[model samples]
Target: MPGPTDHGRVLVVDDEPQLLRALRINLRARGFQVATEATGAEALKAAARSAFDVIVLDLGLPDLDGLEVLAGLRGWTAVPVIVLSARTDSSDKVAALDAGADDYVTKPFGMEEFVARLRAAIRRGAASASPEPAIVKAGDVTIDLAGKRVTRAGEPVRLTPTEWGILDLLARNPGRLVGQRELLTSVWGPAYVGQSNYLRVYLASLRRKLEEDPSDPRHLLTEPGMGYRFEPS
Candidate 1:
């Protein structure tokens, strides 16, 4: 409903008083409704009670492990959780991600980087892929534009906002080869159209998730020096 830049709620869960204060001040300054909790139990309760746009979670807690809190939250909520902790080991990061953290930020992080990551996570969490009500069919992939859903060969497919936006744009212009410029502009906005690397990376991910053979894609066809096309089967 509202744009991402508008006011939204954020829950900062950490035992450290200094970090909690800093996050509260910074996030409030950036136009977010901030809530702070000092324990895993309180974090879980807060999650259950209120709708939080993004969660800045610390790995170590006094009562319960942060991983437990992450798992608990993921059980019922897809609320974007960003793990912020001093644990920089690969294992710790992987564990948090595996437990369903949307993003991970290590401690001693730059405020700019932290804010950027937070913005991206929040944008992704709240972004609606579909612009208006319409059903788009491209091969086995059926995108219910209004419903904001995608299904492949009768099986539902879960897509992030960015992935769904890309698919929706391509489906809207079936049979026409949507150039890199148009697709990028349509999905990520004009400011990002020149970032070819972004297109390449996301296309690869989409193909991997949707195509029968990512190497030899059936529906998502890449036009070298051009862009991509969605050919319905």
Candidate 2:
């Protein structure tokens, strides 16, 4: 039951009973509504039913791998997710973040740091959460925003995950200038917002795949010294 004192809703997914209990108690005491699930499958079902302010996820699950869960959630929602995992490998952390987790915390973390990270994720989720179009049409390319599929000239066009992320943001706001800074931050993360070269490379790849003329793009337009635009005419 949500109360007047509740700060926001939190969904915590971990297989450990003790850990789940601790997180629920701590989060609820901090004025956040809390839901706990032991498996990734249940977590996905709960997420589908109710919107949450943030999600704390553990990479180890009995039914579904945490990375798979992240992919499933990103297919529909932009809710902030903090991965709570026992795995300390740097590669594992990078994979989770790339798969859509907002943050990753290894096991035996301090409660203070966990809460602080969750707060940051909540802030980010608020700014990013919104509805996306089902489909967008460009000159000879078609973007199925909801399905995460794309086609060019009536043929399917395979795109890498990074390419899809860049294109998805632009297609969501057709004819609107999606600034370079926003694209860099949203797709790559805040740290890489200064890396304009990353955007150039991915955008070039997107253009090559979806544009009839890669050199003279009709749909994907670059605004000099500004950003890129998707002219969905």
Candidate 3:
């Protein structure tokens, strides 16, 4: 029986029977609903059919490669996945992370540490599960996307049409990367797709109006050479 706080539903994917049984017993004893799959195909099917709080996946699978399964999962779901593997090489860890794994735990790990990691991953997933609210509050600033309004410290912040467009797009997709070219083409016309300077200028103006410190933005983030991500605190 699970208590109020014991709401974690975990999916463990591994080909090794002994490891699966051990994890199932330990996790279930700790009041986690545990589901196990022996093959990557089975794991994919199980994940598609159910809603899991977190996933513990083995890199070495009998049918499909673990990375392939990870790619498949990332295609439709944003579920948190932790990679469990015997490969100790840094390249393997990097590959797994690049393929969308939330965390990587080398094999022969301590049960206590693994459980702690599982808890942390579940916490992160839960935090990012919900979309941004209608009125997004970040530090001293608040953005009302639906109302097309921005305020800071109880005062309305004035913004141009272009600035509002950029802020609105970013606010709608919190914690997800919005590419530069995508932003330009969407906000401006397709002819302005390569005009990266437009973003730099508009973003600076946006920060000045909405951020407490224009030079160091908190909610508005830039992934150098890649894109921007809006993080709501």
Which predicted model would earn the best TM-score? Answer: 3
- Please provide, for model 3 over 118-166, each residue's C-alpha lDDT reduced to its tens digit, 9 standing for 90 to 100: 9888877876676656898888788998799888888999899999999
Give all candidates' CA lDDT scores: 0.80, 0.83, 0.85
Error of 1 at 140 (Å): 9.2
Model 1: per-residue lDDT, tens digit, 197-220?
887888889888888889988888
Q: What's the true lDDT of residue 50 in model 3?
A: 92
List candidate 1 segments past 4 Å from native.
1-5, 128-233
Residue 73 alpha-carbon offset, candidate 3, angstroms: 1.6
Clash pairs, candidate 3, are: none
Candidate 3 Cα RMSD after full superposition onto the native fold (Å): 5.5
Arrange candidates by TM-score, descending: 3, 1, 2
Which 10 consecutive residues of model 1 have the lowest summed lDDT? 124-133
Candidate 2 — which pairs collide?
Answer: none
Off by over 4 Å in 3: 1-6, 88-95, 127-132, 147-217, 220-233
- Model 2: what TM-score? 0.59
Query: Residue-wise lDDT of candidate 2 within 124-221, one digit each (tens)?
Result: 66655545568888877788988999987888999889999998898876655566666887898879966889988888888888877899998899
